[model samples]
Target: MLYIQEMHEGMKVAGIYLCKSRTAAVTKNGKNYDNVILMDKTGTIDAKIWEPDSAGIEEFDALEYVDVVGDVTKYNGNLQMSLKRARKAREGEYDPKEYLPTSDKNTEDMYKALLTFVDKVENPYLHKLLEKYFREDAAFAYRFKTASAAKTVHHSFIGGLLQHTLYVTNLCYYFTKYYPILNRDLLLTAAICHDIGKTVEISAFPENDYTDDGQLLGHIMIGAEMIHDTAKEIPGFPKKLESDLKHCILAHHGEYEFGSPKKPALAEALALNLADNADARLEFITELFKANMQKPDSEWFGFNRLLESNFRKTGDLNAL
Candidate 1:
């Protein structure tokens, strides 16, 4: 199979890929075309059907599998497909798993690492709260382990949520070590629970897009509500601790412009906000580099809206 990542300009590709989305549009010249997004485990690529009425073109819709024959082309520094033909694949033609992108890391290993942080929470109330969702709830544990952190940004593959949670937790753990002024227990708890709502925010793989709840409530608000409702079940859970934890979740985005319902107020909340932002931005840049790995090491990658800059690979150390 030709993975999307392995595709390059001028290559001819023929394989079955999931149709992530499709749309009909009219060119400025009044010609009609179909814009499509195709996906395989490696990543997604934009595709265009310039002659939609061509006899060989088969009918298909978004979320269906289709066999495509196309020429790769570069547009605006990104690889895209200029389609020659496409047809819906038959039942025995493809495996669904091949079309979903997944984390290279083992999901179980990521979950275990997250638990180590959970075990370190010394505060009794915080510890119990963590235990309720992560330890005691089996269904939630499975969902959390399998969920993606987002539909597109940073970690968007299967097991991505757990991988991202562990990274943020590790970062928060180190922050507490280097700066003892921060509350280790509070910050770590916030880190693990920060994106927990993502389990519901985005649907599972193959349909890893926003849920109705995700659109209406978002992960931040949903996560805060999850923590609050769970804490209410614990006997004699401290009201102030619950409030502080929710505050951490609500304010973790750091600013109103960034979707943070409340800006970081507590010292621990501030630490978590910084850790979360740094991890997300760094991971995004790393993925951008990987997608363009075939380009010359010194070649400029392209302008990145997220980082607000163009990027290029540093020279190889061996050359030095």
Candidate 2:
């Protein structure tokens, strides 16, 4: 079995992988090919099925497992597979869990750390609102521990939501410490609950695609509505506090172009936005470099709009 990270140009790979997606297309000269996404436990890679009509091609769809034989090639510094043969995997051929990546952090440890923040929240109404989702709600707790932060972004794996929430919550803790003006209770509570709607936004594993609500309202809107509903259930939850909390969730996206419904009107909202953006962008860059590590002396990493610079990871120029 060839781990995707170890693949190099012209290397042969044979393994059972999940067919994340498959798209048929034609080149400018009318040559047909298939653009596919293949996934194993490590990560996903872009694969081209040049011989889609070949005799060995399998009848399969995204989410199905298949045994694939391919030549590894580097495309713009990222590994891409050129499939020579593929067939739907039979029962006992592969374990589904092996095809899904999970956070290295312990889920239980992450959840318990989050609970400490919930305990320290001073505002009664905000505390209770967070409790409704994080502490008392058994089902939401179960899903949150298992859910991914995004279907394909930072923290998009099992235990990812918990890992990301822990990081953002920790960020808020330090933010409140540094800036005495920031609302510790409001920021911490908002941190824990900001992405709660993502539980419903994306489907559970093996098919972690967008749901109907995820596509229509998105996590930001759905999360705001969720907080509003929960705030109503709590007795004497201040209306203004409820509004501010929702503002944090809505404005957490930070900028209008990034889909934030509102800019960070409150200082606490701004803090949460920065924390969220930092975690997401850092994780994305880390994953990008991991995928491109095969080429040490590489030039530009193509067009990575997120990092803004294709920071070249050059080989040991110091060696010579």
Candidate 3:
């Protein structure tokens, strides 16, 4: 199969791909075209179907598998597709794994490491809540293992939630040593559970978009509600501890403008929010550099939202 990453100008491709998005619009000259984004494990490529009304082109919604015939061309130094013929693929036409992106880390191993943190937690209520979702609840376990951390942004892949959670928990563990003021049990518990709401907020593979509940209430709200309900089930759980844990989840996004209903009110909440942003912004900035490096002989990079300004990495690191 001709992967998008392997594509070059003038190469004709005939293969199956997942249609990530499809939009139809008329040009100023009145010619209609199907502007599309096609996806595979190598990442996404923009596609232009020049003749949308023709019989050769077929209807396929986003998330549907499709077979395409097109010439790969360079647009702004990136490879793009110009479709001569395309149609929605029939069942048995393509492998499902080929379309989805996956994490480099082992999902099972990552989950196991997460449980070790649960074992280390001294609070009985926090430990029990962690177990209910991570081990005891079969459905939640399946979704947590399968769901991506985000639709785009950072950690958008299978096992992404596990990877992100583990990273945050490790950071929290170290934070406990530096800041003795932050309670180890409370801080680590919040770290483990911070993004657990993503299991409900985002649907599993082939449809990783926001769910109805996710759209109506963001992950922060969903997580706070989940923690509140689970805390109630545990007898003798400290009221102050419950509030602190829930605050960490609520403020993990950092500010209300970013969907954090509350800013980091507790010390643990502030620590968790810092860890989350550290992972996210670092990944975003790294991708920005990788994208620029892939371009032919490219040197000076330009405005990247994650970086907040234009930057450059020249051919010679020492020359800078």
Candidate 4:
């Protein structure tokens, strides 16, 4: 199978891919066209059917797997496809697994590593809270392990939420080591639970789009609510401790402009914010580099909205 990531300009594409989305539109010249996004485990590509009514084009909709024949072309420095033909793929013709992006790491191993952090929480209340979600809840554990962290940004593959959580937790653990004033249990617990809301925020693939709740309330708000409700169920859970933990989750984004409902008000909240932002931004850059591997190492990719600047690979210095 020709994965989206392996495609290049001037290549002929003829394969079965999941039609992530499709939209009808009219060109400025009054010609009609269909905008489509095709997906496989590697990634997604923007495609267009210039002649949607052509005999070669058959009925197909978003989220359906289709056999597509197209020519890869570059537009605005990005790869796109001009489709010649497309038809809904039969069930036996395509494997569903190939169409979903997944983390390179093993989900089971990552889940175990996450539990290790849960074990590290020394505060009795925090430990029980962590245990309730991480160790005891089988259904939630399955969703959390398989869910993506975001719709399109960093860590958008299966097992992404778990992988991002573990990375943030590890970073917070290191911060506690250097800054003894930070509450290790509080920070670590916040790190693990920080993105738990994401389990419901984004639906499981092959349609990893935002849920209605995700669009309305977002993961930050949902996560804070989750923490609050869970703590209420635990007997004698300290009110101050519950408030502190929710504060960390609510303020992890660090600013209102970034969608944080509250800014960091506690030492642990501040640490969680730094750790979450660092992991997310670094992973964004990492995925950017991977997607642009075909380009020359020294060539600047261009200005990225998320990075807020032009970016590119620093070519290997050892070869110099």
Sort order, lDDT high to low: 4, 1, 2, 3
- Per-residue lDDT for 1-320 in model 3, tens only? 87776677899999999998888888999888888999887578899998887787877888899999989998886788998878889998899889898887899999889989999987788888888878898888888888889988788888888888899899999999999989999988899899988999998876778999999998888999999998888888788878888889989989878888889878888999999988887666655565554465656676766567887774553221
Alpha carbon lDDT at 154, candidate 3: 81
Model 3 segments more than 4 A misplaced: 6-13, 23-35, 59-61, 71-80, 90-93, 289-293, 299-301, 311-320
Candidate 4 local lDDT, 1-320, one digit each (tens): 88898898999999999999999999999999999999999899999999999999999999999999999999997899999999999989998989898898999999999999999999999999999999899999999999999999899999999999999999999999999989999999999999999988999898899999999999999999999999998999999999999999999999999999999999999999999999999989888877767666457878898789998568642332
Alpha-carbon TM-score of each model against the true structure: 0.92, 0.89, 0.87, 0.93
**Superposed Cα deviation of residue 111, candidate 4 (Å):** 0.4
Q: Write the per-residue lDDT of candidate 1 for residues 116-182, one digit (tens) a residue.
A: 9999999988999999999899999999988888899789998888988999999999999999889
Worst 10 residues of 1 by lDDT: 311-320
- Candidate 4 C-alpha error for residue 318, in Å: 14
lDDT of each: 0.91, 0.87, 0.84, 0.93
**Which whole-number lDDT from 0 to 100 does residue 17 have in model 3?**
94
Worst 10 residues of 2 by lDDT: 311-320
Question: 58 in model 4: Cα distance from truth in Å?
Answer: 1.1
Best by lDDT: 4
